[model samples]
Target: MLAALATFGTSILSALVPFVNLEVYLGVLATRIGDDAAAALTCAAAAGLGTVVGKLVWYWLAARSMQSQWVAKKLSKESWKRTFDRWHTTLAGRPWLTAAVLLAASIAGVPPLLVMSLVAGALRVRLEVFVPTVAVGRAVRAWLILAGVGAVLT
Candidate 1:
């Protein structure tokens, strides 16, 4: 349980600030525990999910707040309008788009949290899909890292 929490927590941390640098933390934990693929994957997934969840909260607030004139005044060239349009048409209304969005972000090396938070706020993707996607991506990333470690050791 604690491990899970830690994994999830790190993801949240990384999500909020793009420069948080989770790799050091992740690598340290994986190395210190004597190397376990499943454990590494679990931790990475949890952390990624935590970040996505945090972004979701931000997205909600931003979305809710955007439904007014006051918020619009602060944006440059009325960016919220564009954000809303893109969010609704490309992401919120579509399930496959969410996966694609998430996958693209991951592939582009966009920080998971930033990706999730922005998508959640911008697209308002359903939590059900967002969370699971995060888990799978993190798991894959962690597994790859473990594999690299194994290669180095041998």
Candidate 2:
């Protein structure tokens, strides 16, 4: 449990920091946690969660800051609106859809930041969707990383 927390805390940190090279940082963390299979999964999951949280902050800002000059120049209001629509659809159309997408992306080695941010932004997911989708995906991802580590170590 403590390991989970520590690993999760790492996720939060990664989320909070901008432009964290997740693979490098996660690789180092995996080494520290243990080169075992399960440990790798744990580390990945934690980082994934952090990345999601971080993107969520951005997504939230995107929702409110649609009129900012930076937002206008960088991203379109139409795009932002589309994202909210998608997120809402995910919530209404299928409650588990977001979580599944998140988990699959994690297992496939997609940068959680990229995948989560885009999806979350496009979807304009609520805080409710944000929490569980990220949490569950992290749990599964952490397991996968650890399994790989065990395979290599053993």
TM-score of each: 0.71, 0.59
Candidate 2 minimal-lDDT segment of 10 residues:
21-30
How much does candidate 2 score in TM-score? 0.59
Deviation in Å, model 1, residue 151 alpha carbon: 3.5
Alpha-carbon local distance difference test for all models: 0.63, 0.59
RMSD of each: 3.3, 4.5
Model 1 agreement with the true structure over 1-154: per-residue lDDT tens digits: 5776876777677666667766666666666544566676667667666756666666677558655676667544567567656556766567887777676565345635464655575455676777677556655665566556644564
Identify the leading candidate in terms of lDDT.
1
Candidate 1 ranges beyond 4 A from true positions = 1-4, 68-70, 74-88, 107-116
Regions more than 4 Å wrong, model 2: 1-5, 18-52, 73-97, 109-112
